[model samples]
Each structure stands twice: as structure tokens, then as C-alpha cells.
Target: MKRLPGHGLRRGQAVTVTVDGEPTAAYLGESVAVALMAHGDLSTRATKGGENRGLFCGMGVCFDCVAVVDGVPGTRACVTWVRDGMVIERQDGPGARRAAPGG
Candidate 1:
């Protein structure tokens, strides 16, 4: 795992969070939502009616935790990691959408 240099997090303030199934280098300096949104992943999940969902609330009070981050299901996108190899995908529901052939 690659470490990202930041000063806001104290020696005992930093914590590592994984997104999807990939390892992410993140700090506890900011909200988990902001960190994940910064990854350029505009769409975190597809609604039941097939609508795209993004960061609406910066707080962890929302139900946007429908994603699977690090094998944990229902993880909130707005409250997650910010780094490389964070395996994010448009969550279909409790289960994941099967990838298209050769995708």
C-alpha cells in the first residue's frame, strides 16, 4: 500500500480504509465521502429504476452506503477511501451486477 502525505491527520489520527476490494491510501483528516468522490467516480450506484447516484450528502447519515468496498457490502460512497486501486462500481442493489462478457 502506498502512503499519501498529508498534515491534517495527527500521528494517531490516520486510519486506512479500503474501497471495493482494492487497497486505498487514505487519512482520517476529512469526511469519507469527499475522499471517495475525489476519485473521479461520478456514479457510485444505479438506482432500482436505473438512475445514477453520486455524493448528495457529505455526512454519513445518508443511505448511500450501498456499495461494496473491501468485500463489505452496503458501504457508503460518501464515507469511504481516496486513493489508487479502489475497486468501485455502480452498485445494482444488495448484490452486484454481473460484468458483461469480456468487459
Candidate 2:
């Protein structure tokens, strides 16, 4: 999804987050999903058969945006905030719960 224009928006402090080891620009208080999407990372996790899924429903209700952050599995990117130096990884198979470093 395209980022909305900055009009009528108030962003927080500047911060840098790492997605799959790649440094990405972000802002404090922004959701990890937003941070990932802002950096062109739309896929967050893989389901059965290696089908990737991403931010769906946006809110915490849908778990499609779940990923790995700071070594924690099943972290809902849409609800988790991004912090400076935060490390995010794309989740592999949900059953395996393995995290891989890449887009």
C-alpha cells in the first residue's frame, strides 16, 4: 500500500529500524507493519506452501501481519511499535516458526 501524504500528520521522533538486517528509516510510535511497508516490505510471514502474507485488516484483530522482532516470534507488526535499532525478521512457516533475514 502507498504511504499517505504527510498532510495533517504529526510524526514522532526519527528512528531507524532493521528489517531482515536491512536498515530502514522510521519514526517513533509507528507500528512495525507501517515501518516495514514504508520500506517496501509488504510480506511479513509465510503460510503453508510458502505463500506469504502481510498486513491485513491493519488492526490487531487479524494476525496476518505477524512477524519476528528481536527474536520474538508471532509479533504482530501492525500492533508492535518500532524503535531505534529494532530488528525485524520475516517469519518462515508458521508451524516451524523460523525467522529469516531478508525481504
- Among these predictions, the greatest TM-score belongs to 2
Task: Tell me the lDDT of model 1 at 77.
Answer: 63
RMSD of each: 6.1, 3.5
When summed lDDT is taken over every stretch of 10 residues in candidate 1, the lowest stretch is 11-20
Candidate 2 residues lying further than 4 Å off, grouped into runs, are: 1-6, 95-103
Per-residue C-alpha lDDT of model 2 across residues 1-103, encoded as one tens digit per residue: 3568866877899998888778888999899998877878688888877888999988889898888898888899999999999998878867344454452
- Deviation of model 2 at 87, angstroms: 0.4
Error of 1 at 80 (Å): 3.4
True-structure lDDT of candidate 2: 0.83
Which one is best on lDDT? Answer: 2
Clash count for candidate 1 is 6
Q: Alpha carbon lDDT of residue 28, candidate 2?
A: 95
Task: Candidate 1: give the clashing pairs.
Answer: 20-69, 20-70, 33-78, 65-74, 65-75, 65-76
Query: lDDT by residue for model 1 over 13-97, one digit each (tens)?
Result: 4445554443445554454455455545566666777776766765667776456554555777665644443454446666574
Give candidate 2's root-mean-square deviation (CA, Å).
Answer: 3.5
- Measured against the true structure, the TM-scores of the candidates, in listed sequence, are 0.52, 0.82
